[model samples]
Target: MEEQQKKEDGLLNKEETDTLHVDQILRALNPRGRYQILHILLVLLGIPSAGFQLLSNVFIAKRVPHRCAGPPDGSGWSDIFGDTGNLTIVQGRCKLLLTDNSSVVDSAPCVYGHQYKMPENASVISQFDLVCDMDWLARLSQSMVIAGQGVGVVINTFLSDRFGRKTVLVSTSFCLLGCGLAVAYAPNAIVFVVLKFLIGGFQQGILVSKATLFVELLPVEYRSVQSWLSGCTWGFSMMLFAFIAFCFRLRSLFFQTYENDSFMDESLRWLIANGKMKQAQKVIRRIARMNKRSETTILQQIQEKLVLRKENGAEDSERPHKLVGQESCQRLSLLDVLKVKRLLFNSVCLWFCW
Candidate 1:
């Protein structure tokens, strides 16, 4: 009788009960509130880091050009002047507009300033020029940094369905980091372009998985708009990147590069989504400590979700699943869709209707 009661009781253990409480709250306060919270959190997460990254880049140029170059020239002026020089690289857009100048009009095949600039003092092989070509091609390269991010979004959407969220995130993260590093150190312009493309592809996969995983874990009401809002964060994130890019000029990879001022930002969300919950907890604890706040154990949160999902799954799958009228309806086979008679009839009908 006790066992029967235990099984029959709807009340769950500590975890499930807490989850139930949260569900009740979700149901009580409109889902809109939670989505707002989610959006706020995402924006909060994306903006500050982006700002820091930007400001840090500026600081690197102004305060620490030595960090990029081997040593400071004992004069602090280069650091200040570096910011002024960095502008030429980011805002220039002559590269994309006129692709074939020779065939078309006054346009000529534009290359980077670093590529063909002839040095006055050096011989044919040794001559160098610091002046960038400032053509449409360079403009396209500038646009690609943000365009690549959008590509990441599209790529992630498809991959999430095929390869599961966690796997895609980790694999893509590793790939992005590798490609990004390669981009930072590519030997030539061609190699740099290839690496940048790879970085964009991998980044897209990572973002999709991140979005899917977050939505899956979020409460249902929070899931709807929050999903779309998360996407909005990416747009906002681009602005953030632009800010950072403006500040953090990438003129030279090793000798000079912008710093990302993400002040102690070990993204716990990234760690948790990647199955590094222990590390996440450590991060949470550290944050709590730094802020002089109390830390909440997520273990209970996990246990509750597990029980709730398991119970829901048991309730769903225990009974034989069935197809409804729309689902059960036979889809027209390809043969039916492409039948010659059907095509002719449709064409004739279209002609008559038109």
Candidate 2:
């Protein structure tokens, strides 16, 4: 009877260890070190560029000086209109009056088109003449870019979950760079808005992936401070956007090089989550070597943890009914949350916030 009790106790211990193996591996890895800092910085480089691209429409859709098109000398407005207190040359900049005192002039939009008086700078507004009656197009263009960002957030998050974060990050970076170049040379408003939308989408993907990569590389204790610091990049990018857009016109070209050239490795947590344990183990060893720690110690801990799980699986075969019951309890679906009133209320609130 004593031997039977000892055997039952050992089986329960094995079950507990098997369920908590991933957590144990995470705890075993020293997540805080020089390697963590380096990974954070490398991933963070793409963020400011994303911000710059996001706010770039502000500069591209800038309002410039404009007036009614046609020669000012040949127009009869000079004879009919005079420089009165209320009636001046500037007042009729875009329109001309038939009689100043009568107030019976036929109002008309810019006849030929509108003449823009911008400085020696080219933008989407100047290139396409999105002024006067077409001013709303500028606002619409900006809105489309923002809408693209929302779409990107949902799609990219889903892709990251399925295809892994590294794959989505690299693909989106190139897409953004290519689309931005297309925006610079767009022949019409339709093409420009389409390209801008795509740029906004890809930009969001990079932003989410960068943050994900940074947080995963950090230790639990340092995550709060690290996240706070990372958030500051947005503000930095706003200021940098002005300099890059005004002084340097090749911001997208720079982004292309920055993203594609980085020789960074994928996240170890991601590798493990995807069931690529061999790749994860290699990454762990590499991280340990970079941090000047003993790789043997890390590898040994991982092997021992894995062996314990295998042993637990062999013993679990004897208790099929218990295993099936545990599996059913552990597997939860979205509908299960709605069955619980408290969980359903929290989920509704979370959806609204999102």
Top candidate (TM-score): 2
Instruction: List the candidates' TM-scores in order.
Output: 0.40, 0.73
Where model 2 places Cα greater than 4 Å from the true spot, the runs are 1-29, 71-104, 249-258, 303-354
* Tens digit of per-residue lDDT, candidate 1, span 253-324: 321322221233333333433344355455445543444443332333434555666667745335342221
Estimate the TM-score for candidate 2.
0.73
Count of steric clashes across candidates, in order: 15, 0
**Angstrom error at residue 197, model 2:** 1.4
RMSD of each: 15.3, 7.7
lDDT of each: 0.42, 0.65
Who wins the lDDT comparison? 2
Rate residue 220 of model 2 by lDDT. 56
Off by over 4 Å in 1: 1-158, 224-232, 252-354
Q: Give the local distance difference test score of model 1.
A: 0.42
